[model samples]
Target: MIKTSIQSSASEIKSAREDFFYEQPGSLPGTLSIEEDAPPPVIVLIDYNETHATRKQVSTPEECIPYLDSKSVSWVDVQGLGNEDILQRLGNVFKLHPLLLEDVVNVPQRPKVEDHENQLVIIARMVIPKEHKIGFYSEQVGFVLGKNYLLTVQEEPEHDCFETVRQRIRQNKGTLRKQQADYLLYTLLDSIIDGFFPVLEDYGEVIEDLEEEVVSKPTRKTLEKIYRVRRDLLTLRRAIWPQRDAINSLIRDGSTQISESVRIYLRDCYDHAVQVLDMVETYRELAAGLMDVYLSAVSNRMNEIMKLLTVISSIFIPLTFIAGVYGMNFNTERSPWNMPELNWYWGYPLCLMAMGAIAALLVVFFWRRGWFENYSTIADDTNNKNYGSKINLLWRRSRR
Candidate 1:
């Protein structure tokens, strides 16, 4: 799971590097699509009963239609919705509504849930970390829950967190083999909910790293990443908040399709969803506070830079004017007022000493005033490995 999260974060950072901007909102649903290079769908299935179980990759959605009506549980897993033709046909074979198919094909249709008469459709966002980066790539997952079968749509063939569920069913490791479709739905939802843990853990690590960076080495990009994390967390918050309410409504409002036994499982799923939402909200608050700190740190840095420049100019200006005055070669022999200071044997050394003394005095004054120490005291290093390098980086980058 940790390896998977690392890969997800790397992928998202790379994708984000491309500078993909958003279009106008509320245009239409299922509007966004995959490029021509997208891989074809890979369909896998699991059919099981208390007595027996089977798992295989089926070639077409029609192949599963017969099993859908059977007494045993059927799970048709479609990973990749790039082939819109196959997706539309799959919708037909399963008697899916147009909007539901649209939602499934739309790639990222906002992690959501919708009711479609006899079918219960759920949209979830799952994160898989990239191989070597610091953020996670979010993928949309759509599930169509029916009376005897469950159909799920995944966006990529390269990623999924269903291995545990598959192992449980194959080994009959749990009561899953004897359960109904709704229980299967819970199992999948539980996996998706659990998947957020690693992603959230990644963010927690990020926030810790950021707290140090912001206070010690605040950069424009650091501010950018903070805002990005806040924005993505908001995306997450918006996604999970509704699903919690949706699940709560299911548990409280009562739905016939959800059995009493499955309702209990859904309640557990709801709890996990609520937990995810809570963590996201907390992270959002922390990120916002970090932004404020970043702004103040940057402002403080600017003031420090200006103060250094001011000190240099203030000490040098008067000294330069005094030197300019005596350097004039007017002969004191012709007039005593002409160059009396220059006639003094110790004049040059005295002026030099005075300038040096003034500079040293200003330094001591600033040091005593506690102005330099205040800004320098804030240490912002995250990820305990970088003890001093990051601090030095901040020092070089600091203005004053």
Candidate 2:
């Protein structure tokens, strides 16, 4: 189950590839490249003015036509991109350009802005932190802003960060009810940019926990987490970099669809995007640094192991030499030197005492040199530090 969930999170964080939804080289400019498994479109129409607001789900795109031309600002949110017939009807209902519709239908178009005479097309990428997980889910959101109407098309209906905006509209909070559709666009974009904060915050906490693990007990799993965090941050970087440019274009370009007041709000959104990009870059660098720390920790561990082995070998070398010298046969009857010692009444006892004394002296020498003390110090340090449970908790949280 853990493996499956991890694979799922990886796929979720990896947004649909552009090549999968790209039109053929000579294909028509207006041709759509929808995925085979795209969810059927779900239409939600929200029309409001200063006095009141009304939101309802519409079964057909034609149902939204009546509110588009009304004096009140209308927001038609189309989620999912499966049904070509309904999507085509939605384009016709809003009188969207062929190329505009194609861009909206494409799953992974780069975040950008295109201004038509009557409508402004803004393409954006939205990311939502996965529930109780380490990664995020990303999708494309296209905005078509007109005089008093805004059309938004999303890749899927399951995950979105606009619930707060919807709730604000429902509760009649703030000046949203009185603003035009362009202001609504600004509000939603602000929400999208703000959504990145929670995801980044999660990564920050994960990195902190990882730092502890890397210092105390760096393992292969810790290395894997570092790589994963770096990868996810890169994904976020790719997402926000283009989005910042798109928002800047919205602010700098002279598009009538966006009012000056709304552009001012968009500038704030652009700043938030820039802030998110900075956080992503900072986290990425820290993760890269963690890789180096992990390598050093592993090398230090190996050095400790080798030191222990060297100490044992040093103590045994003299004892092995003494044993080898005694084991040699000099033919005691033929050589007086060997024969006299061999016949001594206490010879075996004296030989044993000499070997024991030699071993004890060697041990004392090593102790005086602080070699033995280091082993005790290392053991004490390892016993005193206790962060294993915390590391496990972090890993469990990330897995979930």
Candidate 3:
């Protein structure tokens, strides 16, 4: 186990060194690590005013330099972190802090908030819904907000929640155009936070369904599903909990770049994060309870089956032994003294009557104990006010 642990840790270190790196603490703040596999940069420039908005996909990050100093609130979006040199040039173009560049290039530093002179670099985690499952595609989002512009660098050129923000800016749909770069950052963060609701809601419904399944007809699959849900909730909790703290810290630690109004929006964002945590924790505990219920239900079922088989054997075993003894011919004709009861006129009738009475008594005993019903139909008896019928079912089925 220790060796396995060592191997896993070594693999993780190798991945880290190979994948991405942020600046060492207090080193040049905007430094970049050019990973060997880093891809060419994809830049998107979105510059907008209260009356109009324009967007463009640029091949080079340097193309965005002219608009950064403009009065319009410009959003320079860089997607993919494959090319280190281009990312560095992009950072220099925006006058991004060395540490900020490092944070962006690192792909996934923890979701955090930091101030770099005139720029506020906010690192956040975003998750896109998985197409085939309940889990999400996690991405690191680095936001560099300045007085006149906001630069966001994403890990890849894939899924993002920025479309809504883009639409709002383009259509002049809401207060987005009236606000500054900080508000735009808030919009994107809020979109990412909102995305979790759908995933969490899926888990919520699954958990509710499991509640019935565990108590009614739990199988090994039910147990496995409960465990997986718990495990995934742990993953989500780990993700959202820190993001919540990050937002709260940002609110508490004021930045000159973030307007007072935008700070209010950030507080709202923090509240949403809290709500996410609450739902995650609630689902986790509920899933745990279902697991316990499943274990108890299975054990109860086994015990019931055993009881039924025991009853059948107990009744039939003695009766069969008596019949077997009577079936034996003890040379009664040769010696009536040896088998006087056999010669009695009503001997056979009396013996048969006695056996019938014993069988009847056993039937009455099983009935009174309510141990002659099918256990497999427990789920059908969900609306039952009492469990007696289900127990009887279990016994009857076991005897069969």
Tell me how many clashing residue pairs each candidate has: 20, 0, 18
Task: Tell me the lDDT of candidate 3.
Answer: 0.77
| Model 1 agreement with the true structure over 1-400: per-residue lDDT tens digits | 3553455467457654432224347766544465576678999988999999998999878899889899999999998867877887898998987767877777555555676578888777776656576666667778888889999988888887888999999899878988899898889878877676566666776887788888878987996788678767765665577667767776786665679989888887887787777677777787777877787888888888887788778767777887787777899889888878777899889988887887788778767887455554465335644532333233223313
**Which candidate ranks first by TM-score, i.e. highest?**
2
- Single out the weakest 10-residue window by summed lDDT for candidate 2: 375-384
| lDDT of residue 355 for candidate 2 | 78
Of 2 and 3, the candidate ahead on TM-score is 2
Which candidate leads the pack in lDDT? Answer: 2
- Which residue pairs in candidate 2 have backbone atoms (N, alpha carbon, C) closer than 3 angstroms, thus clashing? none
Alpha-carbon runs more than 4 Å astray in model 1: 1-35, 345-374, 379-400
RMSD to truth, every model: 9.1, 6.6, 9.6
Instruction: Write down the lDDT of every candidate, Cα atoms only.
Output: 0.75, 0.82, 0.77
lDDT of 2 by residue, 263-373 (tens): 888887887887788778877787777777777777777877887888888877887987788778678788678746767799899988887898789789878887754
Cα deviation at 326, candidate 2, in Å, is: 1.3
Please give the distance, in angstroms, between residue 365's alpha carbon in candidate 1 and its true position after superposition.
5.3
User: For model 3, how does the per-residue alpha-carbon lDDT over 199-239 read when each residue is reduced to its tens digit?
Assistant: 77667767767877877789979876876777667667767
